[model samples]
Target: MSLLSKIAEIEAEMARTQKNKATNYHLGLLKAKLAKLKQQLISGSSGKGGGGGTDGFDVTKTGDARVGLVGFPSVGKSTLLNKLTGTYSEVAAYEFTTLTCVPGVFKYKGAKIQLLDLPGIIEGAKDGKGRGRQVIGVARTCSLILIVLDVMKPLTHKRIIEKEVEGFGIRLNKKPPNITITKKDKGGIIITTTQPLKKIDDETIKSICHEYRISNAQIQIRCQATADDLIDVIEGNRVYVPCIYVLNKIDQITIEELDILSKCPHYVPISAHHEWNLDGLIEKIWQYLDLVRIYTKPKGQIPDYNAPVILKSAETRVEHFCLRIHKTLLAQFKHALVWGKSVKHNPQKVGKEHVLQDEDVVQIIKR
Candidate 1:
């Protein structure tokens, strides 16, 4: 049978199977088989006219961070890009208006954020339908994703879009599972867990592993994860990204409806054409980006507040700061004098290994 046919058969079987302790192992095996077939389909190993390469857009990465605008056609993605970055993306009332990826840049909190207006993706995007792979390929490179949805449309569109993205190995607003698997030479499957396993059992884990052709290995579970989580860990190619659901055309909705929509987490309501609640969107973007702004101070001179060195929150060390300024700065640097919440006292002498906080001022002392 064809890979797609095989995949469909397994899916059908999985759907037919009842969910209970008696069927967990069988369901896990089916999931593993489905994941393997999908991977093969994506890589074009199925030999059924699948493209081996991702025909992604040829957009150069610029600025300190990148964000992507993704959604169905004519859902204000183009409008959002144009208004936010003052870049034209050919807005229209018809579907599939933006054919290619349109990139725009804007500065916020001393950091330049690059936003890409991607082509609208339809259902079955994960299976390479409607420029889906190309759009998702660009989205995978983004630091954050803005899923633009029309408030007038059914909210079911959100779930459909999310499923499409997830099928392409993108885990939106999720963390990696705290499960670890190590392959061993001859030992049998060794299972260890720091916490109790409630969602998945030992047999199901083994069944999934066996389907993946893993025989001798040690598995460690640190969290209460489900069968899907175990499968994700086995696949090992998932990308966990932050996503914001941009509910556009809120101007057409009633005030009471808007209030109800506002209660949803990670959702921002706005009228892209009217420029409503845009400041709130920007604020939320800044918060999710988790950027650090470090000011440079020359010896016996005031800190330069006009421009600050921007760094990601995870890479806010003094060494990273120096590298951002200049590669040679680290070679000549002895230490840094930091003045911020990161330091106990103002203007504390610290080494290059010291981590910096947002809006911190620093003076470098040469060796």
Candidate 2:
């Protein structure tokens, strides 16, 4: 049987199998096998003559961060791109209007954000349908994903798009599982957990590991983990990213319906055509991106407030800030005087390792 056929057979079996303590091991093994098959399919397709070349989808990474607009065709992705960035992406009332990746840039909160309007993806995108691989490949590189959906059928489209991205190893709005697997030469599978295992057991874990040909390894479960989590760790190629569901065409929906959608988490309802609630969308994007703005203060001079240095929240250390300014700045750096929420006192002397906070004023004092 073909790889696709084999994958389908395994999926069918997994669906038919009941979930219980007795079937958990079987299910775990099946999941491992399924993940392996999917990996093979991805590798094979990306190889020579596999037709997985991302020719036009390779957009240059510019700006402070990148966000991708992904959804079914004619779902207002192009319209959103145009409205937000003033970049033409061939807005149309038809599906697949934007055939390739179209990139645009917009500035928000002193940060230059690059937004990409990707081609509309169809079902079975992970299996290489409708140039889906190339579209999703670009998505994997995004810092955040804006899933543009038609407000009328938002949930239906959301689920399909989520599945398509998930199938391609993109875990939207989720953190990586707290499971660690270390390979060894000889000692058999050793399982350790800091918390109780509610969703997965030792036998199931062993079965999953064995399926991946991992005979000797140390597995540490830090939280309540499941078979899927174990499988994700074994696969080891997952991308965890935040996603905002841009429910477009909200002008067609009633106020009551819009209110209901507003209650949903990570959802921003807007009318791309009429340009409604776009400010809320931009705010949510800034929030999800978790960026920190550090104002530079020269010695005996006022801090540069107009052009703040933008850094990701996770990389807001004094060293990172210096590196952002210039690579050689770190070599001449002595210490930083930080005046913000990150420091206990205003203008506290801090080392390069000190982490910075948003809206912080940093004055570098070199030796």
Candidate 3:
């Protein structure tokens, strides 16, 4: 039988199989097998495999960060893209109008953020139905995801989109679980944890590792994680990203309905056509990206506020800032004077290893 057909069969068996302590190990093994098959299908390694990619939908990733817009058909994603970035993405009153990825640039706080308007994905998208896997493939590369939805449609659409993305190993609004696995050549499988594991058990872990053929490995799980999270680390293709639900077309809904949607966790209600509540959305994006802006002050002149060197929080160091400006600066650099929250006193002299903060003013003094 074909891989897809076998996958269907396994899924049917899993659905038929009831959950109990006696069947947990079997269920875990089946889940691992299902994940492996899905991974193969996504990597284009199985029979009748063509889905698992963006093909021509791949756009050049520019700017500081890339945010992808994903949702169902006719959810006003293209309209939102046009309103936010002033880029013309064809918009119509029908479904599937956007058949590919549309790229746009949104400049906020002197940062050029790349916004991608992906084609609306349907229910069985991760299984290669329509352009679902390809569309999700683009999303996996995004720094953040904006799950756009229509307030006029059933809210269940949100759940379906979440499932499709999750199936493709995209963890939305979640951080990578604090789990570590170290493989060994001689030692047998050893498990250690500082805290109790609620979602995953030792037996489940052993079953998953057995399915992956990991015979000798040391596993350390620090937090309460699920079998899926452990499998994600084992598979090593998962993308953990923050997501903001952009509930669109609020103008078509009542005030009470808008209030309800606004209260939903991680969601921002807006009218993309009317450009309502968009500033809040932009602010949320900036907050989630966790970017730090450093203003460069010349030795004798004031700092220019029009443009600031943007750096991610993890790489916001004096040396990193200099490297971003010019590679030669690091070789010729002597010290940097910082005037921000990162330093103790005003204009403190610091070395290349000094970390920077948001809106920090820096002056590089060469030897």
Poorest stretch of ten by lDDT in candidate 2: 43-52
Instruction: Residues 1-367, candidate 1: write the lDDT tens digits.
Output: 9876887798799889999888888887888888888888766632225653434377999999999999999899999999999998998899999888899999998889999999998998887677887888889899999999999883888999998898788999999999999999979789999988877889888888888889999999999898889989999988998999999999999999999999999999999999999999999999888888999999999999988999988899999999999999999998889999999999899999999999999999998
State the RMSD for candidate 2: 1.5
Best by TM-score: 2
Compose the digit string of candidate 2's lDDT tens values, residues 60-100.
99999999999999899998999999999897788888888
TM-score of 1: 0.95
Error of 2 at 282 (Å): 0.1
Candidate 2 local Cα displacement, residue 94, angstroms: 0.7
- Candidate 3 lDDT, tens digit per residue, 1-367? 8767878889999999998777877888888999999888888732245654455686999998999999998999999999999999999999899887999999999999999999999998888788887799899999899999888774799899998999899998888888999999978789999998766789999989999999999999998877778888999988989999988888888898787778878889888889999999999999988889999999799998899999988899899999989999999999999999999999899999999999999999999
List clashing residue pairs in candidate 1: none
Ten-residue segment with the worst summed lDDT in candidate 1? 45-54
Cα deviation at 232, candidate 3, in Å, is 0.8
What are the Cα lDDT values of the candidates?
0.89, 0.91, 0.89
How far does residue 73 in candidate 3 sit from its true spot (Å)?
1.5
